[model samples]
Target chain A: MKFIHTSDWHIGRQLHNQSLLEDQRHVLTQIVELAKSNEVDAVVIAGDIYDRSVPPANAVALLDEVVNQLVNELGIKVIMIAGNHDGHERLGFASRQMQQSGLYIIGPLTSHIEPIVLQGKQGGAAFYPLPYAEPATVRHLYDCAASTHEEAMIALLEAVTAHDSQGLPKVVIGHCFLDGGSESESERPLSIGGADKISPSLFKDFDYTALGHLHGPQYKGQEHTRYSGSILKYSFSEQKQKKSVTLVEFDADNKPQISLLPLTAMRDVRIVDGALDELLAAAENDANRDDYLMVRLSDKHAILDAMGKLRSVYPNVLHLERTGLMASNEQLGIRADHIKKGELEMFADFFSQVSGEPLTQAQQQMMVDTIDALHKSEDNQ
Target chain B: MKFIHTSDWHIGRQLHNQSLLEDQRHVLTQIVELAKSNEVDAVVIAGDIYDRSVPPANAVALLDEVVNQLVNELGIKVIMIAGNHDGHERLGFASRQMQQSGLYIIGPLTSHIEPIVLQGKQGGAAFYPLPYAEPATVRHLYDCAASTHEEAMIALLEAVTAHDSQGLPKVVIGHCFLDGGSESESERPLSIGGADKISPSLFKDFDYTALGHLHGPQYKGQEHTRYSGSILKYSFSEQKQKKSVTLVEFDADNKPQISLLPLTAMRDVRIVDGALDELLAAAENDANRDDYLMVRLSDKHAILDAMGKLRSVYPNVLHLERTGLMASNEQLGIRADHIKKGELEMFADFFSQVSGEPLTQAQQQMMVDTIDALHKSEDNQ
Candidate 1:
């Protein structure tokens, strides 16, 4: 059995208040194309299908179109689980009815965990979806004493595996912060107080485990346990990470072979640092001019209209910073003596530091008069 | 051909900050039971499936459950349209694919309007759904110069009728504020100004019209044109309005016979007016004690713990209004001359009006000192 593993679509995500819908749509289309060319039997989406609990209308429509294309057009089965960011009930709506059409969606944690069995040419494989759930919810639903994410997950896995009498190979799909997995800025903390991390040993009995919530594609201690990662660079910290989906195939004996398939984004994210003239010169010969960019200038003096000038050449410039100005601003911080002074005196000291001049005699007199008038108005009230 | 007509579900609606999900679920279950018992060929929901554009997760799940029972279990076709409150794109997502399972949901205005033709024991009927669309949207979609709701309806009807060549009976489903239709507070205004009101004469060509957007069920001059009203009394203004679903049966000749089927809400809404003692006495013999009630008291003096005392008898009391105290408070309105006085003097007069006393010398001195301290703090800033 061959399947494509992907997760964390975050369809309605925005970077620095800019909509990434078009970029998302472009990449999802590539994913669909990849599935068709590869002729995979089924697709598995681990979790976090949406960026927030309540996605915008456009995001809903995009998911609808993509799902329709996958299940109805390509005639392939899709198994999806709800992640921490999703409203489980909303994501699971109409899931039972959709199952007849090869679209399986698991939502909130239930007492009984059912594995969707898919038949292959050689034999069959069972895919168990353990959706994200709070430890309290799991404990109450299953009548257990699990107090943390790791304990809840272990209890859930044990319950499902105990009921499985079939000798078919088993694959577990989950959304959590595994113990040895690396982290990224875009991924939200699964739980406060660091109780969300789980060890890879819990899934040792399974043939493979496809994980989500970590934004980098890597394995834990076991090669069979992997994070498919996000389909896009969701944050600046993920600029260097290679985004990809995992393709898994089961042999005749149900042994797994894994490969990473790279995804090409609509625009690459780049960070550039140089002086103003040097940066402009570098931008002239850049191949991917439309890529989103963050530029840092090393010039000692202020450059007016720097962002405006850079945007003309690189239309997608997202951020611009001046190292020299930052260093100067650090020096302008008020001293201990200045903090003890009155508000007027502190203002005078800060203004002089920024302008490289002291307050004029006329300006000092105007400030004194303004403060006195303010005092008179306050006294009348 | 027989069909049940209903609309203005407002599934996620809340009354007095109280969640009405249980009430909504109870009524929807009754609706499903009615559909099954009647053995109706199809069920038509005119519009307003949700109270807000983005319904909460539970609302989505509720709708999904009801639709599944109606379409998949009962084996009846459901035709739905988007109302002003619904997010058109989100409501209409996956609608085309769902059509295969006998669920039809129409959304935004389009040039081509296709009718869902259902075959019955006697004959076939074509149900045309005209979902809610703003006048500007209709004008742009059809490339017509329609500045008013009436003009937009006429243009849309013309476009649909121009393409209808089959000699089948036509039933039009619409969600708009029809002229001469009464409304309640719960029903959102269909449009700003007075442009949303459209004449019933526009649907004269159709055999029958199932309308929505009004909380009252009534015919508009013609017997064939009707608003089925909401299944629940959504507001106090609709206290006297009988809530019901319209059951329409067409004979072999395509003639229509319509009857109103009254719906029994789990908890009815009522208003009672009397003195405190009278209200307490009347609450004793009330057969529907669990019903939602709003009380208006005629007590001449301020009553301490009035709400608490009333709730002891009527646990579901939603509102409490004091008519006698209101009359006294009206006489205490600030005088124009008092507005010219200082803030402290105005405050003294307001306090004296409510308490029927003047500030003591000690209190006045304390007020002055407090104001002086506040002024000193402002001066320091």
Candidate 2:
């Protein structure tokens, strides 16, 4: 059976909730489009549906619309598991009814899991859904019969496969970090007592495993076990790689064939190194010029017009850093007299230092006095 | 139709987790036993089965056993709604299946909802399950046509009661804080946006309103609305009242007769105020001595041996506060040295204020010196 394997749809996430919703909505729309065009039989989302246990109304609406498109419009079967970041019970709600609507939810850790079987042109496939598990959950699930998550999962799998009347091709979807998988900046840690690491060997039995919790897509020695990766570029560290989804096909015997489908965003991210105008010129004709850009510039003279100049072209610019490497070669002209002011008092001085700009000595003093006065009453407290 | 209407079953709750589960289990067992003996047709939990959105495994097991007993042993039906404390999706999991097994979950919310009708020996009854709603949820549920929670809830009820087809006695089960209900010590704050209270007029269409929040079985205004209160007494303030389950009998026209079923617990909390020895003497025949007890003693001199003296008889005296209200005779014998040392440094001075132990004069001086040194260091820094 052909299915799209994806996970870690952390809906309602905010980069500190700093108006990134416009960007988030854009990428999420693109993912829905991909699912529609791909005509995938099923879409398996492996957990982390919401960044928090209590999702905001907008986040809930977003999922409702997206799932509606997948199930009602695209006629694609959707199976979701609860991730470590999710409130399992919250995510697991209406799972029984959603199953009738072709949306299956697996949030609770179950010892006797019912494997959802998806039929394909080639034959049939069994979808085993495993939500992320903590030691306490494992202990309770297995009746204290299994001490750790690995033992409990392994035992559950053994019991499930034992009940498989005809050993059809089986695919397991999970939200766990494998021991050998690559991690990206956005992955949350699964703590054991206090440590956030779990062994990867727990998922060895399934024909193919689509894992989540790790933002970077990676393989765990066995080709079938892989990370599906996150949908969007969430951080500066993730700015380099082109994020993608995994598509898999099971042959007649249920043996699988896997491939990656790269996603090109409306705006890619690029970090550039050059002087202000030079960087702006280079950014103009580049393939990823319209992307969210961060630049580090070296300037000797005050570039009072730097941000004004750069933002005209790259409105999504996140940062601009000025280097002192060129100061020895050229007579750098900026207010060195502003340095004596304390750290919080020197906003204009610091901005000048980092932007190769000059703040008037009066402006610098004003910045200092304004900041100091703000703290004057605070000190009394 | 006769059923026990109990709400706010904040399972996994704790009086700091000290004797929390024991009280909860005891109260729940009593509630079920009352239901069994009363030959109730069903048990209706308005909301809040778990304290937090994510309930512990123990809470889940406890719920499972009680629900199983209500259905299998007593042949009673159970209907529930997702309370504000509940994660809607989690409460919704297996809801359909559970409904098929004589359990009705009224969590799936929509704007124009029909009242859930239940048929019993009384002929017929109508139920409207309204989960707690924030302004945003309320707006969304009403399709943005209504912005305020009150307006949205009113719209929802108008739609629900529109199908008052049989004119049967309609009961509304909701998890909301009505404006005038008695607030319990353990109830969580429902809103952070300045105000969170919702008016009780939203239930004018229903004959009996079974409500979940505000853990005291009381009414809002003169309305038929009633709060079943929380299962366990989660705070010391609720010690005097008997935690109970409410039984409602609906006649052919669905007009209701309600009775309060007392839920006796293994331990009853009692407060005794006097000198430690006197209070202990008064508690000698504690009919419920195995009960948890709090002892408040008032004395001018420090009773360094208080807990030691009281623990022998009232073993579960979890609290011993020295309120320091002295009688005239006790204050008559104060030595000059005792006055100089103040109450804390006298030989009879109470145990260390924090640890409840007798403090040596030398130890007291050292503590003062250390605090002084630390303050000096901080000031220097």
Per-residue lDDT over B1-381 for candidate 2, one digit per residue giving the tens place of the 0 to 100 score: 787899888887766335366677777888888888888888889988877665655576567667767776677788888877775654554354445456777554756554667776556677777877665667776766655555666766776667755777778887776776676556765543224566887776578889888887887854467888777676666776677888899766657888888777667766677776666777667666666767767766776678878878877777766666545435524532343342224423555545677666677666655654553343222
Lowest lDDT 10-residue stretch of candidate 1 chain A? A372-381
lDDT of 1 by residue, B175-226 (tens): 9988888767677665433678999988887889999898899889689898
Which numbered prediction scores highest in lDDT against the true structure? 1
User: Per-candidate TM vs. native?
Assistant: 0.82, 0.68
- Docking category of candidate 2: incorrect
Instruction: Encode model 1's per-residue lDDT on A190-228: one tens digit a residue.
Output: 754467889988888788898888888998978888899
* DockQ class, candidate 1: incorrect
Q: What is the TM-score of chain A in candidate 1?
A: 0.84
As for model 2, its CA RMSD to the true structure in angstroms is: 14.7
